[model samples]
Target chain A: MILTVTLNTALDVTYRVDRLRPHGSNRVRAKAERAGGKGVNVARVLRALGREAVVTGFAGGTAGAALRRELAEAGLPERLLPIAGETRRTVAVVDESAGDTTLLLEPGPTVPAEDWERMLHHLGRLLPGAAAVVLSGSLPPGVPEDAYGRLVRLAHDHGVPAVVDADGAALRAALAAGPDLVKPNADELAAATGLADPAAAAAALLDGGAAAVVASLGPDGLIASTPQGSWRARPPRPLAGNPTGAGDAAVAALTLGLVDATPWPQRLAEAVALSAAAVRAPLAGDFDPDVHRRLRPLVDVRPLHPPRSA
Target chain B: MILTVTLNTALDVTYRVDRLRPHGSNRVRAKAERAGGKGVNVARVLRALGREAVVTGFAGGTAGAALRRELAEAGLPERLLPIAGETRRTVAVVDESAGDTTLLLEPGPTVPAEDWERMLHHLGRLLPGAAAVVLSGSLPPGVPEDAYGRLVRLAHDHGVPAVVDADGAALRAALAAGPDLVKPNADELAAATGLADPAAAAAALLDGGAAAVVASLGPDGLIASTPQGSWRARPPRPLAGNPTGAGDAAVAALTLGLVDATPWPQRLAEAVALSAAAVRAPLAGDFDPDVHRRLRPLVDVRPLHPPRSA
Candidate 1:
């Protein structure tokens, strides 16, 4: 089973209304809720692709219990640690008439030191049995800035590869631990490296200590920079839909590729295909199976040469 | 204890943000969640006024569980019946910069026939020991349109008076069962009786079988039409903060007056004062006790005579 960790997990709630009236009451036509955070979403994608995945993180109060219940209902496995503070919720209010969405994101709870230490111990045991462990998302307040970095070292101790999907402080901190892989979206790549060009940003991450880096460029597809070689993969055509969880879909495919020892080209192709499929689907962590199947072979992969002794 | 029934309860969630950008993601600075519905709000007001108030209603799923937990924390006793469908949530996004709020109200779960039947049995067992039962709010789908009516009849069976805080079909239907009292805001009163005038609307509700009708007219205070006589109560001056639960505050005061057999003028004065005090508070179920006390006796109450056989 692939183990995933989400330190700041959330209850993702969607409210569909006929129209959103600013400063006025809106009657929601429909609503939905689910467990979410980068790692949890990655686990959900892995499960959808027929891979066994288990999630571990901090959950507390009513929202935390509700998150656990939803994960159980969705058939996603979790062994979340209980905390004193309530888990946060992210509300997406969709305006049907305007065809736009407004989001309200709550700052998640602060994890106590004891809870963080307990999590490392929990993951230390689970990592040995898992093929790969994913460390993702932002650190809740009260946790060390290098929270993911510590998890990476723990994975290495268990001889398990760590797939780090985070940005800013968490990403930079984890890079120092020499993670097996790191996935960042366009904005995250730029933020982490302070570079305008994607390739430059990707190269800087490698210099900083990551073994490999995969940057998701949304509709432009993904770029993989590794010691073996660098490659850019693009979907045959742009797909129109929600792009919220597209990166997680790519991460799931890439993690599977690591486990199966697939070639970088083939892995990048799979990542691009699955990501496009996720975009075409409405909710995050869900993809159109048929789209993924049909688009896999058509993905365009090409090698990128390093700068000639600049 | 005064028993307040909220047929369609909600988890009232409030999110505070520095500014609201419609169609864009906003990070919430703070958030809070509590048990709320018209009846729940009324019960909270009663409790704050040093009255022993207990709440009863259908609570199901995570939101319902959260509601019950909050009620316990508030020290309000409850005997809620569980149902299959999840209770709804109401999100109030407060924009601090704009100084306004945007509400997203979920259409609560449809209470199945079996669950509602079980609720009736639950309430019947508790009604006999209650001084009065307050049936408030809209009926969840799958419950009868005359849900409040059934509860009013049940209260009568126990020799207990019934107070209704409802509008539209629920209010109109309950009046036919001869509830001891009914409270409606200006819009609800207009909708229930098709009368533009507050006094006329209150009279219509009384004629429909309610023993008394109290209409909350916002800053204008309240108007009461009872079998004894008619009177209009006005606050000394307008007070403003948040008017969301002003009517529920009024209902809380009126119900207490009924239990104590207070005179109409005094009851109207109390209702007007409490309602205005609620308007001076931020949340729906809270009021400034100082404001209430200062405004109570200062409320101007005057009797109104019916048109002479016109």
Candidate 2:
């Protein structure tokens, strides 16, 4: 079974308002909520595609309980470590008419040192049986940026490959531990390497110690680079839909490839197909099974441009 | 024991932000949560003032459970009726530098017919021995406009006084049921009576079948009218604060008066003093004990104009 970790999970709430007027009260016409964190989203898509994935992370107070209940209802298994404070809620006021989403994110509760250790202990036990472990999302307060690096070494110690999907310092720290794979969007790759071109940024990540790197270019599709080979794949035609969880979908496909020992080119093609399918899905990380199967064969794959002459 | 009813209870969440910009994403710096609804606010204040109060009304799902936990932490007994949907949250974005507050109110979940019946059954059990029943705030969907009226009649049938604090049709409907008291802010009173003068509106409410009426005039204090007498009690000085829960504080004082059978003049004075004291307190419905005591003598009470010539 695939293992996913979301250290700073959130109860994602979306409220539909006619319009959002700052400093003025607006009435919501409809509301939707779901358990959220990068790893959680990845696990959700994995399950939707008929994969077994368990989510483990920090959850506390009422919001945490709500997250667990929502996950259970969605048929996702979660092993959350309890903390003292309530989980955070990220509110998105989506204006139906304008199609604009205004986001308000709370930093979430601070995890005590004891809770952090407890989570590490739990993860240590779960990593042994895991086919691959995916660590994603932000680090909650009181957790050091280097926590992911430590977890990466633990996964390796248990003979399990690890996939890291995070941003900023945590991503930087995790890269030094030689993760099996790292997935970063165009902007996140740019920030990590200060490189404007995706090719240059992907190379930087590969050199930083990842066994390989798959950089998501959104509508531009997926690009994968390894020491032995490189490949590129994109959808037939651009899809129109919310692209919120496309990266998570790609990550899920990548993990599936590792578990099944699929070749790099096939893995890249599958990741591209799943990510495109996710963009067309209304709810995040969910793709229509029939559509997914139909689109899987359409993913066009080719050799990427040779790495920059450095 | 006092029974407080909040038809549309909410989980009040306050998020502190350094600067709030419209159409831009913001990260909340700090967070706080409390059980909120006008009647819940009154009950919390009553408990803080050394009174025993039981909060009864709708609460459901995880957010509702959080609301219950907050009430318990405040040391108040809660008899919340569970429903199918979760309670809503009212977001208050506080800007400390400017001392400005931006409110984002969620309409809360709708109450099913069964939920309403369950609440009525609960009230039926509590009304007989209750000193007073306080019905407050906006009614959730699936509840009739005459819900407050029905509750008022129920209280009267059991020989218990009812104090209602609401706006528009809810308050008007309660008046037709001859509730022991109705508390309307200046705007609601004007809209209810079509009279610009608050005192005249108070008289109109009493004439409309209400046993008594209290007009909350913001920092100007309160105007109270009953069959026995009419009076005005003005706070000595106008103070500025987030006036979110001042009216709830006034309702708490009014409930206290009915229980003690205090005369209208004294009741008006207490209401004004409590409201003023609330402005100085940090949280909603909370009054600084010292300020509450000090403001008692400053409340200026004057006899209302005798029944106007027809």
Candidate 3:
């Protein structure tokens, strides 16, 4: 079973309006809500792929209860540690006429030091039977900066592969713990390594002890570098829809491949196909099975030579 | 004890940002949430005035639970009836730089016919000991359009005074039920009667069997017409601040006066003073006691002559 960790969970709310008028009253035409956070999304995708996945994290207050309820209704297993502060809500105001979305993100509640320790204790119990562990999303306030690094070490101590899907300093810190894989989108890779070239930035993370690095290049697809070799994969054509959960889909595919010891090229191809399928789905943490099946065989994975200097 | 009914309750969320840009992401600098709706505001203000207020309405789902939790934390007594649909949320995006607010309102969950009956049954029990019953806000979907009219009748059956704070058909219907009082702002009165003159519109409701009509005139203060006499009251000067809950505060003061059987001029003066104080407060359902005390003595209430034609 795959174990997914979302330190900062959210109740995602989407409001649809005819148009968003600044400083004006808007009557929302419709609304939809779901439990969300990067690892939660990954777990959802993993479940869709017929894989057993368990979610663990810190959740508190009314919003946290709501999130847990939604997860239960969705049949996603969760073991959330309780805290004093309520979990955050992330709202997306979708303009139906303009086809645009404006986001209002609440900085999640602060988790006390004891809460973090308790979460670690809970996570330690789950790691024993996990095929692979995913440490994803931003660290909430009061959680140490090296939380992902510490989690990576915990997974490794249990002889389980860990995948770190994070950005900036957290990503930088996790690399030294030698996570089995790290997935950073184009912007995140640049932000973490300060390298304009995706390959160079990915290479930097690989050198910092990540066994492999897969960089999502948005519509352009993904570039992955592993100890065995390097490869780039892309969907047959660019697909446009909600891209919110595409990265999480890729992470799910990558983790699945790591558990099965799939070849790097095959794993890269699967990640690209699954991500494109996620983009076609209307909401995050969901994908069209038909679309995934059709695109899987068509994904093009090609070998890429390392930079001459490297 | 005062009884306030909020047929469509809400979780009022306020997000403060540097500025509001339509169709653009906003990083909220601060957030505050509370249980709110027209009658809920009235109940909160009544509590602030040292009156015991009991709130009852339909509440269900996650949002409803959150609203109940907030009300509990605030020490507000509630007898919310259960429903299947989740409660709605009204978001106010406050632009600190522009000094303006953008509102996004969800049309609340639908109430089943059985739910309405259950609520009426519950309200019937509370009316016996109630000093007054306030039917406030718009009726949610599935509720009969003449809901307030029925509620007014219920109150009168128990020999309790009823106040209706509503608009359009609901206000028109309640007038025929002979509610003890009806409060409509200038716009609502005009919309309900299709008359531009506030006095003429108010007279129409009085003619329709309402015992009294009080029209809120925004910065101009309040004009009240009752069988006893007609009066107009204004604060020393127009107070400018958040006007979100000013009318509810006015309703609270008017309800208090009705229970105490205060004279028309004194009641109107109290309403005007309390409303101005509410405007100075940071949030709805709250007022500055100091401001209320200062404005109360200075409010001017004077006899008003009927329109020449009327």
Write one digit per residue (lDDT tens) for candidate 1, span B57-170.
889988899999999999988888888888988999999999999999999899888888898899889998899999988888889998989989999999999999988999
In model 3, the number of clashes is 0
lDDT at residue B105 of model 1 (Cα atoms): 92
| Separate DockQ for every predicted complex | 0.87, 0.64, 0.77
**Total clashes for model 2:** 0
Least lDDT summed over 10 consecutive residues: which range in candidate 3 chain B? Answer: B301-310
Candidate 2 is graded, for docking, as medium
Please provide, for model 1 over A1-310, each residue's C-alpha lDDT reduced to its tens digit, 9 standing for 90 to 100.
9988899999999999998999999999988888989888899999999999999889998789989999999999998989999899999999999988999999999888898889888887788889998888888999999888899999999999999999999999999999999999999999988898998899889889998999999999999889877899999999999998999999999999999989999999999999999999888889999999999999999989753342
State the TM-score, rounded to 2 decimals, of chain A in model 2.
0.95
Put down candidate 3 lDDT per residue, B78-154, tens digits, no spaces. 99998999898999999999998999999889999999999889989999989999989998999998999899999
- Model 1: colliding residue pairs: none
lDDT by residue for model 2 over A84-192, one digit each (tens)? 8889998888877777777789997888888888888999899988999999988999998898899999899999999999889999999999999999988899999
* Model 1 error, position B13 (Å): 1.3
Error of 3 at A270 (Å): 1.1
Best by DockQ: 1
Off by over 4 Å in 3: A306-310, B306-310
Model 1 scores a C-alpha lDDT of 0.92
The segments of candidate 1 whose C-alpha lies over 4 angstroms from its true place after superposition are A306-310, B306-310
Better of 1 and 2 by TM-score: 1
Query: 2 or 3, which is superior by lDDT?
Result: 3
